[model samples]
Target chain A: MNLHHAPSSTPLVEMVDIEKHFGGIRAVNGVTLDLYPGEVVGVLGHNGAGKSCLMRILSGAMIPSKGQVRINGQDAQIHSPHDARDLGIETIYQTLALADHLDAPSNLFLGRELKTRFGSLDDGRMMREAVDVLKRLNPNFKNLSDPVSSLSGGQRQVIAIARAIYFDVKILIMDEPTAALGPSETAMVSKLIKQLRDDGIGILLVSHDMHDVFELCDRVVVMNKGKNVGSHRIEDVTKDDVLSLIIKGQLPDDWVPRSQETVQ
Target chain B: MAETDRSPPLVGWNLKLSASSFHKLSALFTLACLIIVFSFGNPAFFSINNGLTVLLQTAVIGLLGIGMTLVIITGGIDLSVGSVLALSGTVTGLCVKAGIPVAPSMAIGVCVGAACGLFNGFVITKMRITPFVATLGMMLIARGVALQLTGAAPISRLGEAFGVLGNGSLFRIIEKGANGFPKVVFPGIPYPVILLAIVAVAAAYLLNRRQIGRHIYATGSNEEAARLSGVAVDRTKMIAYTLSGALAGLSGNVLMSRLITAQPNEGVMYELDAIAAAVIGGASLMGGIGNISGTMIGAFIIGVLRNGLNMAGVSAFIQQILIGFIVILAVYIDQIRNRR
Candidate 1:
């Protein structure tokens, strides 16, 4: 795959030596990953392989027991989802993280609500903006006032995407973006990922789908049992090599690890 | 997959009158029917004097219902409101008897109520106690404190000026008599009714148009999702409980002023009435659904039934049973509408 950034540029996000312990269980133990501008990095792992746990720490849902997360080479302190939003980090959780009873516009502007001069919620202006962003993402989208619980799964996913892109997002973390979607909806998401990547946004895509990683990711990192098995360019490693690494946490004898002069 | 097939719009614009509003309209209809039937039962029930009297009687419960609406919308219960009302009244009565001005003394009463609410919020949020248990404990503690303060007796003999707040009417007309002396014409809307109206309007604005209102609803609807979306769930819940407490305090003062005394054992089982008013007006106990107009109508419904039944020679015992049945019927209807 073609490199999106020059080697001299600093990585947008660097999480080094991350460790997370839940009592006796070390969910994530000593893993490191780097993401650069305009690149999609796929994190592939089985259930309980620590992919979700590691990403949760970066998303500010959980704090790292031992690790340093640097943004633009500067050490950051993120203790909550509010702090993460201030640093332009938005996470689209697998559950979608939406209040099911609120309307479309209310959910789209849940945290970052726009207020009129008189200090009331600018519902009219918010509805207009929601219409603008949602139409571009899903042209068939309607019912701006209906509760999100009444929406279809694909439409709800589009609303969640609208929320992330509606703000000034620098780093987007998506956990299983298409896990519950149909084939057409999945294709729609793949198209959206490419569109966002081309627009110079850094994304951390965590999934168990091999085809999604091969088609949309530039670099793929495999994790097994809380450890990084290997990292390779999508073009350098075949589907079977990545599969073997994910299952056994072992790299083939003939395969060389990707160079990391720029990563460290 | 046939998953692409969209369900025919379950809520159309014509039918888009949300289930909440539809329930509100139905409640209004029920209230109108009750008035008509009672008026037929007794001619006095249809008079303007009786209408004003019913509203005056509803003022205390209406105030409590305002706070109850907020608490219920956040999916929490405040069983201590009635007891807090008694405590606030006793505190204010003591302050007035101690030579403090009535206005500031009343303000102190409301503040005392707010403090109790703050304690309840702290216990529920920081201490991680469930709201039902926390407020239930507060109910007993506040009632006990009120009883201890008054030594199981009522405080009375407050000055005449203190009674004006609850008994006076707005816009009283004065006319020059034949001998050039001012003469009383008409007594306008009662003070407590006007106060209830003002509080209801303010609470409605806060719930429908403000940021905190959204936070309260979101927190009640799905707390984990709200937290992940950057809402201050703890702060929102605290505010709801605090507001509920303040309103209860205000109600205590109004009731005391009207009766010209503060009874240590007053407001017993009053919490049940406040909760009933909210539920009857369409505020779901499950939270994330309610409105002030509905609650006000609900308060009036209870007041009219009680007043009209007394006039019609029905015993208070039967009235209680009927009100209880009405509460159950309202919730059951809400459940059926939601299922559709």
Candidate 2:
């Protein structure tokens, strides 16, 4: 087991040599990655490249077959998504997971619905809160009472992000945040990512779109076929260099995989 | 991905119409049209006597329909509800015959009904059986077991208290008639009607206000999404089926109290009527799209249709055909609405 010790500046989250296998298929091979506070790290890869698989393990949506997840320099247990959320980790899935029949506040607080003194849903208070949060994310937004199904794609994305932040997120994982969005929606998401990073949350974003990686990310981590090739500062690398790493799973001349490998 | 999650039906002139309100309005409109047509066909259909009768008759099915709405909204069906009702009535009858007190006997019957529902929930959740097949199997098994318990004979000899629970009225402002029959000075609420109203109020509050209720809707709308969000999908479905069974049991008790007997064959096909009322009220078999008030309206529609047709000299066989057609029509409308 790879244990992380405290330095007060330890990365917000560290995944040490994670491995996941499904029957004969090794979906995500041994991979190590770290997320620091107040930085946006992009995971770039082709389809089926295990970008989602790695993030899902970190989010506790799926368990790693082998690895230790250290939170704030201490080993933490993440058995389920609820546990992940309780530890101040939230994930914005590509599917967007909104209850289409529910209104904005309802979708924003789906499982963790706010309750009144009598234990009933406090819709009035929830709507008031939803209005406050949603307005800051999208200024021209007005349909707080409308069901999410009728909302535009960008509005829905805003709702998803608003949900995570409202829950007091410390580490945010976004999978393909702008994959289904138009240009305006993409820009909105990009802006939201930068704002979240500025607010001191560690963000792990998975994307295939090079524009989103360059526009919103401080650093890019490329993976191919379930293995992390390397992590690079965006300022030090060009788009083509990262593209080559993603397509060929090649390591940079000075870069090396994290020092330790887990024993079987 | 954008459209995959938006499965709730959309209607024309519906962009502003929240799906729940739209369905409620359409159901109310249908109920109104049915009432007007029936009233025109027979003037007696609009009379106070017939109205009371319709409301009273709506009690049994309406009670089951309330529970059915909850179950259906979770995207599951309880075909065993009618059989569970029969079993509960038979258990109550057996208790009374064994010298048990009337009140406790009925409570035992209701508990037994809840137990039956729990069993259904267990099979579906723990054993991983599809609800349709599990409840279908339970329907057959429960009816057969109920018949076996009673030796295929109806239990009679229930006393005066039995009559009181089923036929008693609230606010005793009545004078004894010439034959010692009670004649009311004021319109009073029947026990069954009172129970129906109380149940509907409580159910409406539970479905609309509570967290479990929200989880139910979430589970039905998208199970995987709900699970990921920390909603207990299995627990929600279990509660839905169990509540449905308990309601079916209570309806059966009220039914047996009125008849003062437990017939092994009683409550046969009652599930169909309850499901039909729920469907007519806009509860989707697909789940997550219904309300109890609309279900009550649907039950009233069924009651009016049956009473009006009978008053119009329509045969029972013809009434069955008409009901079947209405069920079909409601589903067809739902399909078109969902597609749009």
Among the numbered candidates, top DockQ falls to 1
Q: Candidate 2 at B146: error in angstroms?
A: 1.4
Clashing residue pairs, backbone N/CA/C < 3 A, model 1 = none
Superposed Cα RMSD, model 2: 5.2
Off by over 4 Å in 2: A1-7, A252-264, B1-17, B40-43, B176-187, B337-340
What lDDT does candidate 1 reach at residue A137? Answer: 89
**lDDT of candidate 2 over A79-182, digit per residue (tens):** 88888888999888899888776678878888888999999988778878898999987888866766677789888888888888888999999988888888
- Backbone clash total, candidate 1: 0
- Best by the lDDT measure: 1
- What are the chain A TM-scores of the candidates, in order? 0.94, 0.89
In terms of lDDT, the poorest run of 10 residues in model 1 chain B is B1-10
lDDT of the candidates, in the order given? 0.87, 0.84
| Cα TM-score per model | 0.93, 0.90
